[model samples]
Target chain A: MKKKFNLPVRQLATVGAFALFLLLGNFLMAKKIIGLYYTKVLMVAAINMILAVSLNIATGFLGQLPLGSAGFMAVGAYTSAIIMRKVTFVSPALAFPVCIIIGGLAAALCGFIIGLPALRLKGDYIAIITLGFAEIIRIVILNIDSALGITLTYGASNLKNIPKTTTFTNAFIWVFIVCYLVSALMKSRHGRAILSIRDNEIAAESCGINLTYYKTMAFIVYAFFTGIGGALYAGYLGILNPSGFSFAKSIDILVMVVLGGMGSMTGSVISAAVLTIVPEILHAFSDYRMIVYSLLLIVVMIFRPAGLMGNKEFSMDMLTGLFKKKAKGERSKK
Target chain B: MSTFSLIIKQIINGLQLGSIFALVAVGYSMVYGIIRLLNFAHCDIIMVGAYIAWFFMTNFANMPIIAVVASILGCTLLGVTIEKVAYKPLRSSPRISLLITAIGISYLLENTAQLVLGAAAKKVPGFFTAETIRIGQVTVSTASLVTIAVLAVSMVLLTLLVQKTKLGRAMRAVSEDAETAQLMGTNINGTISFTFAVGSALAGIGSVLYCCAYPQVSPTMGSMLGLKAFVAAVLGGIGSIPGAMIGGFMIGLTEVFVSAIGLSTWKDAVVFLILIIILLVKPSGILGKTVSEKV
Candidate 1:
């Protein structure tokens, strides 16, 4: 079966096809065949992909539920937004990466701090604590805006005039970087350790995998990318409101991850893209769109419990394994 | 107001708010205890109940008693349907899958309410006229008295139901061990559906009371309150009813006191602060017993 199918060649072809599709998309956007509005939607999809994939690392791969993605995203968004707003000397080119990094680092710091204590609490308890942390961060931001009187957050004022730095090129570039980085991480030894911990914390711990250290690391890394995604989101949308990063928004991201197969990076990417673009496509049904989305989620849970792609990767081995088992069954029948 | 009066006011307000939290928390704790699933839609049940009450108050202003009874029944039915449709099928699925479904059901309920009812906040007519009773230098509103009375009655009824009734015994048996209970001739589905119905009915009562005290109801109102109630449930111990009440009171008092200290905006932070502090000190919660997870 292994010799009958060349897995590497099929893998390369799949990558090439995706690359070509991305190039064509870039070309279409550049040539204005697709309007800027749609291009902007694609940009949002890229950001969502980053968030969904990063969060999937924690929620999907690690089997740990963390509901504080929005809180961490707000940290990244505000940190980046504040720096970009306040700093005058830096050029947008240098400022962009710096702000994104700072945003990610800030989120990572929060993640590490929260994760240290929270990693000890599993399942629903961890979920609630993380949710509390998110709410606290949001309320703190609101209070800071009110108390300082400096208009730091502009107090219900939409954070405006964020130098728009996220074009399709940059958005796609960052998306690719994040997707590849996380995918590779998931395939690495550290990824194995994270997955192991999710499978059984006790056994993982017994195997000398420090539950605290690895779990915290996965959380920080997840936060870092989510932060970067948030930074991009702030810049792309050109406005940041405290309400925009509410728990509902966090749930939206979670929906994307869950709708996409949890443990599958490709599933996250596809689900994020579909979820982001679908609402726009159903613009006429705006009021009922969310209702439909929610119902769709319920149906998915009831019927397709494994999600859209399950845990399978986009690989030839999976394809050939099907035929190989079929051939064996045929021989046995004969 | 004098300092002592102010202190008394805060305490009363805290108790009033805490009672509401306690009511909602019971729903959360009971559901969690029985199914080990955090019914995110439980909060929306509160919203649905409030809407039902609002429907009654608006269209049937002259029939308050009938309206309240109908609303409770409506919410009870909604809760039962939610369990049968949304949760039962996914019982054997992974915990996260159930969580996602709960969240989806929550969103579905909220959005459905928004679609059917407009996004604007609806006014729930005051159940009773404003009248304050004075005890020496301290005063409490008639509404506060009603809230306290309602909560007390509900608690007594719930305790009686859980302790004295055959259905309650069956519920307890199922919660302790579902498979074994089935062997003992208890209807697992009926008990769970009944539990959801009762829990949601309590949430409905809570919603009506909460709306009366606050006097405004919105479609999105349930999300925050729902989260707070979940926190209360956890703080008191996930499956313990009395613990939920205590947790709710603790949270309510903490919020009221924090606000009184001129940190009104930080009230949310304070709630979480208490949760974190409590969780760190007693990971099992204030009134919760530790259950060992099988390896």
Candidate 2:
């Protein structure tokens, strides 16, 4: 019988290295040498990571191509912002957690509503419905404030003046927490069910899996994180606009998921970081950036149809094995 | 205007708008029927067609008919080329891959048009001006009548092509089952290209009619119209040509009615609301047939 594997010393070093890099980034931002501009960019990247990974759960893991992530995010953003704006007496520290949870719940509720009918549909139909739902949500939000006679100031102009709560530290911490939580979830029993469904819903059902229950669970959970991500985004940007969460934004998030290996947590993180940073670096080609981005996606799909990472996970096995060999050699020398 | 006259005016407006949608929806429905891929680029094709017409009309103003003919032919050729280049190679790829490619093509076309044409909206020359006809207290613009007539002729021609021609038969055969049609000696590539050509040619006509009625053109104009036409196609039953025609009118009338009822802000929302409700109630769409897969 095979024994359980242990993490290698080298794999531990990589994680330690990444953690240190994040720490250094935070330190630099706090010290003011790197400038707040880059820090803001990093925050955007963190929010995008949260969105892309959460969406990967549904589209990549659950095998449902939901184009309504933007709609759900919009719901979460507006709900959290309204809560934060109305409950102004609460401490910012206390409100932060409340906002994230509220955002998540609002998004999950929207997801439940959208998913009830949408989960039953498949492929292009799901995509179209979700796309329509997002547009409807945008339009509804545009008219919502006016309908209530509240002067509906939050469409193209953006929702302003809630609180500036997100900092480099908070955003970095949230990024780590989200990445770890999503990765752990994906390694769990529920994660296995998601993968099974993605492989073949019919076969998975034949294996006695309740397709609707599990699929809805994934959908809800995905919506929850996406909502939190939206909250983080609203807080970081200090403004919320309907235009900010358009179909184009949804497409951008989808690009990250697609570019990252769809089912790979590591792939999501890397792609999110790269896609977020690459455009800023190519600022010289402002007009051509999207054109290049679109072409890159097309080329990548043509060359690597499975995506950049293709369901592979980060493993400590090889690193641990090498570390063990090195330890043995050192002991022999002693 | 009298209430009855107002109603007639609105109905005529709806018909004019619906016919444009029907033109674009036919391309969307045909492409979706054959490949099951919602060619997101189809919208941009309409934009390109409008731009082509604009370029010809602005530069070669002396020969207006030749310019119109050239724009339609240019757009048709462009559509066929896109199919040959981007779509055909990815035929066997996953739906998501093809979807991304369609989006890529869409962005490529839109951005290219923006770079070439500039971001500002352009004014297209009016095909007819200073002419109105009145009937029973209702006055209709000449352009509106022309739009209705052009759409009617386009529909009739499309119906004949789909129902009567040998190529149309081949298109139907391939759409039903590509491999089976190939086995039956149909040139799959040729049929698909022809489908794109016909669909794009119609888009060209739609663009001319749209520019005439609206009198404005922009690179991004096709995005909203394309999405609306897609909704219309789905409403009428995707893959059914007659269904697209009916769906187009329904969407146009609904939009007008929503705006007329003092819910101007909710016009876009109403269109989508209708789509969601339809999809929830009838997954195959209004006129679409459900095809069960044999395991």
Candidate 3:
């Protein structure tokens, strides 16, 4: 008898691919093959991937249309930025991780509070409330200092000069970890329950799934990672403005999810990369970029509502299936 | 101004703003009632309407009435076309897809405006003379009077159209149940197009009023305005016409009062905070029907 390698192929591939990506990134950076502009694009794509994947939990898995991903990001960005700014005694490496946690927790708390009352409503109502919440968040950030007599948030003006802690390596690592955790969570029993709710709410309820509990849980998870992405974004920019996290920003992330396939994590990653990079490559169309992007959204939604992937997960089985078909073809030729 | 006059003036201001919001909210609630869409682009239609009015008044005809009518007609055509093109194809798709399309359409309109007219805010030429009418210590601008008058007339005419006419019945039937309405020989497509036209017309009227008061038009103006009007629709209980009117008024009042209390910067926040509280306390809204999902 021969012993065989039976370790999870998907997990192994993910680790291998991520390691390879990091190595390639380092090589490119070291050799100056990757310029500042390209590196910035890659980092932004990583942040968007994190956003799209986390939003998939709520919009894709849980079947909720929350148009407030940017609000959570804003909370994370501001909280983490404030922490990094105020906590000058800590090392950048130590402070960076702590700020991510703090920012994520703050956004999670906001999600819990918002979802408590909001998730009760059905359909478009939730979208409206979430949008309003995002705007309200912006407005509060704009006027909070004046209202509270505190100098925090700086009141609508851009909060500038924070440490730049988000390197390509760490961003890639964070995105990898988030994607791994999200995929794992989606594979668990809890993920199935959430998927059931998305498929059929009444039937899901009859099966004894706690609708409110699961809904809020998914939302909080979505907010938590959105916050982390925002924290990463803040560090990447070293300055923050509430305007950057406007309703348009939320729509930007939503477009990626919708274009990628709401329920497919791999779809989100692909679309996020394509959408982010395509715009940069076509710099001449910068003015028409939004127009074209929006036109694509309407066309895609009209033609392929399930998105480019249509709820299909990318798996190692796909690769093996292709190989097996090729092998059979070779055998027939022989 | 004395505190009493100042308070009175703010009330007038609130009413003027509320009427415009109510007009926009009416379109929002009507479209939602018929198609079950939030119609994110509805407010952008208002932006288009404003620009059309600006173009007509500045370039074609300087007459305010011509500008107003042209704007309304332009929006009606644009709204109907958008429905036919972007939304109609996705009619059978999931609600989320339609919502995303609406957002896309909104982005398209905003970007087009940005590309064509530039992102800088354009000062809209005054459509009416600024005349002040005094009632005791409180003075009200003619714009406020005209806005209230327009809102009143539109509301009455809309109520009559919705309650008494054959097309209105068809609209009601489609909104209630499209399949059943189609089964009963209602022109579902026509009614939907009509709904869009009426809603867009109202948005056009709202835009004129908004420009009268604010006097500035920009590509991004519709977003905040649309969001607030949607809040008004939600607050009034979506799918209910009269509810939208009350919701709009409440939002306007809240915004004005917030500013009156020297929290002008927080006015937008206050409006949203009120919406959240209303949702938490009564998610169905002040005038919206409580929908019971059948298990």
True contacts kept of each: 0.77, 0.66, 0.85
Name every residue pair that clashes in candidate 3.
B237-B288
Candidate 2, residues A66-115, lDDT tens digits: the string is 77878888888888787777777778767987897898898998888887
- Name model 3 segments beyond 4 Å from true: A1-9, A329-334, B60-62
What TM-score does candidate 3 reach?
A: 0.96
Look at candidate 1 and tell me the lDDT of residue B203. 92
TM-score top scorer: 3
Model 1 Cα lDDT, one tens digit per residue, A138-164: 887777877776678764667788888
Candidate 3, B1-295: lDDT as tens digits? 8988888898889999999999999999999999999999998999998888777767754579988998899889999999999999888888888998999999999999999999998877877655788878788998998998999999999999999999999999998889999999999999999999999999999988998888888998998899899889889988788898898888898889988888888788778888889888888789777777645
Docking class of 1: medium
- Best-to-worst order by lDDT is 3, 1, 2
Model 2: CAPRI class: medium
**Every prediction: chain A TM-score:** 0.89, 0.88, 0.95
DockQ of each: 0.70, 0.65, 0.78
Say which candidate scores most in lDDT: 3
Give lDDT tens digits, candidate 3, residues A128-198: 77888888888888878888899899866889888899999998899998998998898899989899999
